[model samples]
Target chain A: MAEGQFCNKSTVNTEEGIRHLLSDTNGKTYYKEMEALEVDSAAIQATFSKTLKSRLKTWLEICTHCGLCADSCFYYLANEKAPNQVPSYKIQSTLGELVKRKGKVDAKFMMDAMDTAWSKCTCCNRCSQYCPFGIDMGIMFGYLRGILYSQGFVPWEMKIGAGMHRVYQAQMDITSEDWVDTVEWMEEETEEEYLGLKIPIDKENADIIYTVNAREPKHYPEDIAEAAALFHITGEDWTVPSVGWEETSIAMFAGDWEACKIQVESVYDAMERLKPKRMVVTECGHAYRATVTEGPYWAGLKDGKTPVESIHYVEWVAEVLRNGKLKLDPTKKIKEPVTYQDSCNYIRNAGLSNDARYIMSMIAEDFREMKPSKEHNFCCGGGGGLNGIGRYRKQRDAGLAVKHKQIMDTGAKLVISPCHNCWDAIRDLEEVYEDGIRWSFLKPILLKMAIIPEHMIPKDE
Target chain B: MLYDYVTGPIALISLVIFFVGITARVVLYIRGLDWRLDRVTYTVNVKYGIKGALRSLFFWMMPYGTRSWRVKPIVTFFVFALHIGVLFTPIFLSAHNIILKEKFNFSFFTIPDALADILTIIVIVSAVVLLIRRLVLPEVRNITDFKDYMMIAITIAPFLTGFLAYHQAGDSQFWTIVHIISGEIMLVAIPFTKLSHFVMFFCTRVQIGMDYGIKRGGMKKGYSGQNW
Candidate 1:
């Protein structure tokens, strides 16, 4: 089991213990799938042809192996400084070896490569922030995943999620009808609290086409209601489309460019049909990044211009607050000291750190900053679709040790994370570390603090 | 006669290789420019990108931008000092300028002999510190390969020989010839080894800042307090 080999007893579960838990489960299928894949040089070269570029080449060539990036990785810190967990080592062993071998490798090497690329590294890009060379390891790992994905070697969870997106147009496989019903249900639920609240659906030419993660509909319907309530009070013209409504992209995480293209194309098509001036994505980090940053290129847009402007909901809300569209009641602030967990995509990828912090300061009465907040903040160990992969639960949990210590040092009662994956990972950490800290999305906190005008209040209320 | 050949023909060949090889690499990178259209969907703010690129170039020149400074402040200081020393010594040192004046018929700048000596000492001492760290630190040592050590030796040779020649410590003429030869070797090796980072560092940083800083909205006027 190698108990306490990688991490302290408090944070790390024994490998043997994890194996025991997975003995009867489908976790064993992942390794079997890796072993079963028919990998060859041609396929490997084809993958590289699709993924490789000058930037990646420069990164591979210029990395000095300064080891500065080691401290930036949560897995490295959590795993008692395992050298293999170092970001450069991960790239060196997998991509480095592949390049060294000229794309000729055996199945055992592929197995090791897959584990290193998919399981160990989360593609969070925190190391890039620390890298003196400015090498984005996250993008590098994404390319590695793309190569592995071409070989049909991916975690089962990712495969299922990508399939669900292809078939059902949502990561959770929620049907269009179910999506509509869920929004309608959320409207009804919110109506009970604030009368005359409506979740406008399929409205054309709206100022904003608001989209949400499939998890909002399938699991956390309250988040939908919370967002709806905020929009209702703020008097913003927003609508949710039934088709292409789910913004999360499992295809992007799985590195299936075709599937990723389909997911993004659907959303862009929806936006084009609805003719929204802008699209506001809910608190899903990867979804927002995939749509706003990477979607245009995936869709083959020449100039990197989308049909419609896109903004993360955090940025949208902050803009709305700055524009005086909605007033926040200082008296209704959260009494407990709170800290914000900067999502890697939102902060590092999108530069929304200040916007999120600006919103939090307006809402939280006592806001304490994490020691290393914003772009430098450690990943919550759930990025790169690792949260969805059930086979790596123990590894992901142990990886939370670095984040756990960061949160504990803040001495805050509540941690507000703006991204779905960050929220889920932090919640898992709460359970794993038994840290009695509560977690909430920024939407709920915003809804709690926004002062509703008397005229906007329901007549019944 | 051997010293003259090493200082004249070999040195000239090394310079030719250095410039030609570096120019080729740069040309290749230019041809391979990744429009980065995948990650940036809007009209790139070139003005902001250039500004951010310049800012990042200067920011990382010091040790303040990374957290490793906190863990190994001494190493950080030495590394930073070494960079400063190596970059300035060749360009501004009076001895190098005398040679430049004779060969190229022009000299742009010259530092005092004492200052040049001090900078040379900084380079030599920092090289030692870096080498020791590479050997001692498991994290650093694991990544350290033969080429890494070779590059370090190649880099140190010129500075060490130059310092010895300047001081006329032992066989001053012999040391001077060794310094010129070693310096020539380094010039030839720069574009071929990890030393290429010396030329590509700014290009890479500029791309990073342009993509991340301008496109991703981190391009604030000053250090945005984000790690970058």
Candidate 2:
């Protein structure tokens, strides 16, 4: 077993990262945008105040503080089982602050509490699973963040996520033109491999609507290329909506509940308009978890029933593999030690962690387990809009010791984290804590292993 | 003999307090249920079907006189013993039991000599342990409201009186009178007091579960699970 004593690093390199995160005039304009959109600030405040009572009541009532909750917390486990890192303490600190002030605390308290609540605890809900009394601190924090967002006390970086959601109803802030251009670019790149394959956009009566995370278009176009290649090889009937295809809803992360509800609703509306048989979320844990699980009802999708079916990318990939649509040359992708980091939103929330591992095994020859895998996976310490807030670097790095050690223990040079936030958060952890573990999406690895028959090299030479 | 137990003032006060307490609790429970169920938003997930809802409801009913096999039998019995003894002892028996017998010729079940004595001891001991647990455990301590202590005190009074009256120990009848008055006070206090948690728990759980289940894919098969 790996070991480490608890260390609290409070010194934030504020000047370095905080400059990038300062909310500009454009950011402040979101309040106006919301007002223009008829969002009632006073109504929202009242709703938040009401929510605070239930949230506080739940906080005060549910926990029996058995401390068994601490044993399974990745943060606590990493910190030599320190009492402070215990999952309950995070809730206790904020709830105590709220009670002490009777919800009349100043903005400074909001900033401090939001950072501690959001940056420190990933919304993995792993502690909820392990708690003897089933206290859902993650959900509680989600509400706390929501209340904070209503008050406009949101940290700078998280505002971007909500801004993206407000602007495009997506996470990555990829504009409509950018999405079309990215798809066209990827389609061109993949056509060289598929001869004359086309990635359809807004095609009516398609069997499925393939949605991609904003990261694929915003930063990692190759990830989208792999998705195109897989679909091209499979000959599956899929379409990407030019209007509403960006899948990740950072509004959900920013604790902008109304914004999140709208974003989720837009996806449903797109699905209904296209009348697709199903919706396939490309390699995003939170996107899939929210769309298929939490977001639908929150958006009032329960009047009748949800329109289109939804499945995670792992499930789709496994289906494609089973159907003999994709062939793989595992040897090409098997060079170094490889391990899978289960995304919490997918593993615990969506139950796709094993499906991801099963997919990983097909491509990586050196696939190994990260001890406590699947539903029990640790958070990457970058959830709940932590990465969005540049002010949280110190706590993010220091609090993520559990995930850092888990990655280190696997001794794997390559770690495949399927979710975009995990990739960002884990990569940030590597840089800040100097715990180097090469991280990439599983899609890229699968691309290296995948072989289209037409592109296959001849055996005779 | 009848006059020996309940004089005019005890009967009048006991009946009035008991009626008012029961009415208030029922009203609060109904109102709280309406408000909680009418809530527009909920976050928890409940997957079990109507079968599950009934299971949860019926299981909770065990301490209220309905029993179920699925819940923890021993724990349920202990809890049931505590609840029933608290509810029935002063209001229905011992003090009020004596008052009705002496004044109105209305008698409920008299606790048998053996069971009564055994249960009286258990009730007092369990109340002390529960109070100590509330005080000692940090999690429990953190959430404990002031009303919780009062409820515990109200619950334990009858058992304490029964203990004193068992041996006719030291003006035991006067102590029994004190127990009857306190029990009546609790009934009047129950609806307005946090003791309504007794009824609120089921409604809230059901509401939370339904909200969660409908949000999760279990409610709608082909609907896009997206939250909007």
Candidate 3:
């Protein structure tokens, strides 16, 4: 409630929010990428050169280092006392050096600045919380990262994260065929539990359009099965797109604004084309946050363009429970105590704090709160592509100590995190932080644990 | 001695400036119109609410908690020397004493006879050092905006007038008047301009004290110098 404090902690507190929101406008090369098939090599290089010079100049002139920005950074806190890691100080070292040198600085400076701007930062906006001056140092660094990204100066591992967005629009790189096959396969598997329940694909006039993060199709396909199972038990008339239903947007995180636009556009265009009554995004935090809160603004699609109603999975599940579409036995309970891990994007970014709790109450009996839970939740160490970098293991673990402590204090046998990044990040913390807690996504856990009355199960046979 | 005639106008301007300047500075602080020290470091409250605005306003007033104390060595030393000279010279000096008495009926604070002369000399020298540093240092040079360059210029004008008025060398009264008026103009501008960085500087140090002394936390923790 402090004057500068924001309810959207994920954007204002996390490195990705700091980097992505501020740096959203950085990808000027997106135009070039679109023209890459036609433009000559020299011209492309020249444009890049001009973009770098102009962006760097703007970066240098704007910043006045007051050091207030360093206070809230998780990385800054985790690293003991290093001045250079502070957002303002970090900008001063790289962009500041370039300004001081007037572009006379060599490639070595570029390389060094690139390393600090991209690899060292999680692009979380937590530092922005402490800055009294309203300097979006994360945005400044994000722009610089965009320029470096254009130059192929990013760490290779980070490239995979970006490339996943580039090739598949999701971090796990699921293809259209992969998505269809995966959903169809999961729907068939669910038939044993619900007779001939359907995972409707691209159904016209359906009440809701559903999207899943690529990670589900690629790795945790069973989680999608659980979601499908929930839909079947509720008899919800929802349809998943044959394609463009992948909701992860790494382009936003990587500072590639054009790619961000494209990824978001893919979904929006799909919405317009499909005209589903409402869209339900799966539990991936960033994608859901971006589609509803940020994508509309960033893509120049303001209040009018896509008012197709958007809801997160938590909201959808709560709707089913409230509507009595699904019969959930309140007497049904999990064997052990369970607690909810509020995804930063869900609680802070999308205002889903109550939604997660509401959904949790329907499924789990012993739901306990983590201290400073909901909007004030700490990021899972791997949320913002930190898990992608092999070298960041120590730093990631160190930054996650606060989260580990929160989880340990909960003393719950199960942790239900709704976001894939939280899922992976907490799983890593389980191994590294030694909490030894079993975890599952909220929707999946609910589907598996909740007792569905026989009347709710589809009589497809 | 005849310089008193010219200095009379400058002294009158200085007096007017003092009244108007203090009033304006206080008004801005009370209204929270001035930019906050935390804006650069914290998440600026972009939404509507009294709580967010007031929180920002509170920290803006007492920024000692947010700003850094590790002033660049040259910057710190010269700034300190200059502030002492500037703050003391106008109030304590005999030449100005005559004008204040004639104009507003005010006089020196303490040890005026000795301290006035010493403070005047320090003020003049420090102002010159500041001008030179602004031009010479690259990092400082990059950060210094046009207003910064002009601050040094404005600062020097008053001191020069005072110095000239002291020696009774040139239009002493006029120089004295110019010095007093310019000094007063600056006092009024202090709260509004980046010069209010003084407010932030003090607040930053205070915050460090509270954070370390009361919170009992390591005050200087941070990450490696990575860009993103």
Query: What lDDT score belongs to each candidate, Candidate 1 first?
Result: 0.79, 0.62, 0.59
All candidates' chain B TM-scores are 0.87, 0.65, 0.59
Best by TM-score: 1
- Can you write out model 2's per-residue Cα lDDT over B5-80, one digit (the tens) per residue? 4445655766676567656644543344322222223323323334334433543454532212222345445555
lDDT tens per residue, model 1, A1-461: 11211111111123443333234356564456456455668867865665576678889887888888888888989999987778888898889889778689876787688777777888888877777778878888888887776665667667656666776777875889999999999898888687678899999999989998999999999999999988888888999988989888888888777777878888988998999998999998988877777777788876565678888888888888988887898899888889999888878877788788878878888898887888878888898999888778888898988888889998996998889999999999888878698898878778777888786576753
1 or 2, greater by TM-score = 1
The DockQ figures for the candidates are 0.47, 0.10, 0.06
- Candidate 2, superposed: residue stretches over 4 Å from native: A1-45, A48-105, A120-137, A289-294, A297-299, A304-306, A321-342, A351-378, A404-416, A429-440, A448-461, B1-171, B181-195, B217-228
| lDDT of candidate 2 over A1-461, digit per residue (tens) | 11101101111123322233334443444322322232233544565455545424543444434344565666666666655667777777775556555666544565566666666676777765444223567777776676666655555556556656765666655678888999999988877666657889888889889887787888888777788777776778988888778667777776777667777787887887888998888877778766666665566654423467788787888778767787787568676788887887766665455467668777777788886777667787776667666566776677677777788888886788878778887888788667567888767666677776664322443
lDDT of 1 at A331: 91
The number of the candidate with the highest DockQ is 1
Instruction: Give a tens-digit lDDT track for model 3, residues B118-190.
Output: 7767777777776676566443454455776666667667777666766778777677667666766676555
Residue A306 C-alpha lDDT in model 3: 43
In CAPRI terms, model 1 is classed as acceptable
Residue A393 of model 1, lDDT score: 80
Which residues of candidate 1, in runs, are more than 4 Å off?
A1-27, A49-51, A455-461, B36-44, B63-72, B219-227
Cα lDDT tens digits, model 3, A120-224, are: 566554443344443445546766666555544454445445555555655554668888999899988887787757888888778888988877888888878
TM-score (C-alpha, index-matched) for candidate 3: 0.63
